[model samples]
Target: MISYVKGPLVDIFEDTVIIEAGYIGLEIHVPLSVLDRLPGIGMETILYTYFQVREDGMCLYGFLNRQDLRMFKQLISVSGIGPKGALGVLSAMTPDDLRVAIISGDAKAISRAPGIGVKTAQRVILDLKDKIDMADVLPAQFAAAEGPEISAGGVAKEAIEALVALGYSQTEANRAVGKVEVSDDMTSEDVLKASLKHLAFL
Candidate 1:
């Protein structure tokens, strides 16, 4: 029932953290990525969490952001993956990278996780590919202007987001936007209108 835990961090272990809130120390399992970002021991900490109850025990899984938590829940929804397996997957790669892999159908990348195998990795992709969108696959890529959209500014970024909202894949959006000759004074609508013309060719 706990949505999140906010308090001073009591301890940091290999795969778990103890956050003391209201005099109770709650043990939370988290990905290795979370450990790298956590503050020093006893510092104030906040983690979005998922609580699981089994016949044997109860546990909490935590993430630094809602995206990771959302990815974790999506991972566990697959047939062969559980909370721990999902944690391992998130530990292997960021949620963004995982989304890219799923979009590209790269099961090999996912199989590198601690306990996941090729078959299970493929199953993960098969199950989650439709659940995720290509728009989330490479936000950093677009923001850094590393991809076809050479500018991360208002016009190009909004055109990409709008195209994705229109149900086109991100790859399609980027290719379309990049071909349009955007002027400095162009609004997002101007770029979007020009991008739509280019989208037909893509």
Candidate 2:
């Protein structure tokens, strides 16, 4: 099993990244948060990873921190939760926030994740509520500002297309980008810049 990888970041899209290591580019599916933290092309990065094998193929999911990876692992253990479903949850909330929701039995917050319904949300809380250490995951600040830092550019559409190419559902891509502060001075590039950061909030 691939535990982790350290390499040069070769590409960044909405939900995946290409990291070059040992003369090969390993494509990893990631949540929006990791995408936001990604440096520009050629930057060095290291990721804690989880590998999923199936009848069709094997895929890799990665996280910026081990805590996030742990949460992803726990999420996949739930019945009816696949890698994509787990990713959906992680994409909507931080590991800490997720733990808080589960500990507090906040079904509404859990259900807010795309494709996750109230029943599944309740199940998630029921199954994992006792399994997690709340103190370990909750951030000190619960109401901090969300979204990515915006810049001046006109590449919002380009960034969205890039995200789509990386295999994110269009709805997910739109949601990630929509959180940014759009303005008349903001171009597509500006949108992309902001979107990258906003993606991290998930």
The TM-score obtained by model 2 is: 0.67
Which residues of candidate 2, in runs, are more than 4 Å off? 138-202
Per-residue lDDT of 1-202 in model 1, one digit per residue for the tens? Answer: 9899999999999999999999999999999999999999989999999999999999999998887898899999999899999999999998877875775567888899999999999999889877874445434444343334444476688778867866689999899889878777776655765675565444
- lDDT by residue (tens digit), candidate 2, 1-202: 9999899999987889999989999999999878877788998999999999999999999999888898899999889889999998988987767875775567888899998999999899888977885335323231131234533323454446644644556876688677776675654534544554455446
Model 1, runs deviating above 4 Å: 140-202
Q: Rate the local accuracy (lDDT) of all candidates.
A: 0.82, 0.75
Q: State the number of backbone clashes in model 1.
A: 0
In angstroms, what RMSD does candidate 2 have relative to the true structure? 13.9
Error of 1 at 1 (Å): 0.9
List the lowest-lDDT window of 10 residues for candidate 2: 138-147
